[model samples]
Target: MDSEKAVPGDGVVVRAIRAGEWGQARRLRLEALRDPVAELAFLESYEAAAAKPDAHWREWTAGAAEGTRDRQQFIAETAGGEWVGSVTVLLERAGTVDPFGGTVACDQGHVVGVFVGPAYRGDGAGVTRALFDAALEWAWAADVERVRLYVHERNTRAEAFYRKAGFVASGVRATGPAGVGGFELEYEMKRSA
Candidate 1:
């Protein structure tokens, strides 16, 4: 599914990231990690991501770009070709273990790495909405029964956006690891299809 926002003149189009565009993906990810809210919004640190080698990015993009069933990343870009935002979805199957060390009891899509540039935030543009719509549509197309995402309790902006997008709290809470600072509350959101 195409990830074009309905509002014209925004010049932002969301689409599946290409494997060869790993450089663009890496740049956007590094920028996301540098956001002021990165500590609460992402699990990885900018230093850690920046330390990774180019080979790592190549492999990362190959696995998450379009055509990969286990994972996919959608990028929001401008007409002039700047990547302004991105979101990735990971397929979790029944009985498998997730990154947070939780058991997946059903076929679902796990949303992660959600971000929009500071200059492009808010509803007036819809860049974030377009990226999310693409991710959810991709998951549903793969017969995923549900789509889930975890947000830090401190990230009210993301939580509010998820709520607006039809993702309800699943009443699940988990303690984050040392990588995410000590003992942060993580809330789970499930798409209400």
Candidate 2:
């Protein structure tokens, strides 16, 4: 399905992940997890993520395609049909708390699992930026006051990208499990005035 098309340096389409696109999602996700820097950004291992049941993949893709009370996922595809990048957004309810140890003071969205294949990195075809623009537009259209994401302390590249896209550090740090020591830094971008 044609969701949204972006004319980055090259033509790329940023669209919602369709129902049957689970297999494609699985493939891209595995490829992302295998990237050398995956350990610094993604929480799941390639082996574990690749082994998830088809039902799980179906559910994940369906929710992102149609959107639910809490989540959505969007994909970036090159004109040649190559899956190049992805981003997922999770809505956090007011007064509730998130899994990363933050209380939801206002209705907001959390962007996660952002990745772009190395080939497309730094091209500024606007593929990745367009994905965030679409996601934030959706969240703000839903009356969300802000959108936030957490980046690993070691992921300076991601941190720089987010900042360039208008996010600022929230000065909040979350510690992961012992094996994954080091804090995750919180960054937020509120709807512009």
Candidate 3:
């Protein structure tokens, strides 16, 4: 599902990222890492992400881009062609281990790497909403039992948005993705019966 939001003059469209757009993916990720709340919003630090080589980006982007079996990244870009935001969904098969070493009790989509450029944040958060809409649609299409995301304890703003997007707390707490002291609360949208 492609969504259009009134951000730029001509508006922005949300769609799955492509493999050849690795450069845009890398640059957009760096931009996201620079956001003020990025420390709590993302798992990796700016320095760590920026230090990755072009090859790392190419391979990573390729894996997360459309055509991959396990993941898909949906990005929002203006009609003028500037990327505004992105949200990626990763499929975790039941009986497998997740990135955090937790057992995946069921097939699910784990949403991550959510971001909207500063210019397109807040009142213009339509970009973010559109991004999530696309990401969630993709997850549901993949027939996951549910879609979940982890948010930092102190990141109230992000948690609010996730709630608004229909995800509710799962009563599970785990170490933040960075392996830091803070806890990351799990939020999920279980598939309707």
Candidate 1 structure quality by residue, lDDT tens digits, 117-159: 9988888878888888899899988887788888887788988
Q: Candidate 1, residue 138: CA error in Å?
A: 0.2
What is the lDDT, from 0 to 100, of the residue 152 in candidate 3? 93
Compare the candidates by TM-score and give the number of the best one.
Answer: 2
The lDDT per prediction is: 0.84, 0.84, 0.86
Question: Which regions of candidate 3 are displaced past 4 Å?
Answer: 1-10, 177-180
For candidate 1, give the lDDT: 0.84
**Alpha-carbon shift of residue 77 in model 1 (angstroms):** 0.4
What is candidate 1's CA lDDT for residue 121? 86
Clashing residue pairs, candidate 3? none
Task: Give me the runs in candidate 1 sitting further than 4 Å from their true place.
Answer: 3-7, 177-193
- Global CA lDDT of candidate 2, please? 0.84
Report clash pairs, candidate 1: none
TM-score of each: 0.91, 0.93, 0.92
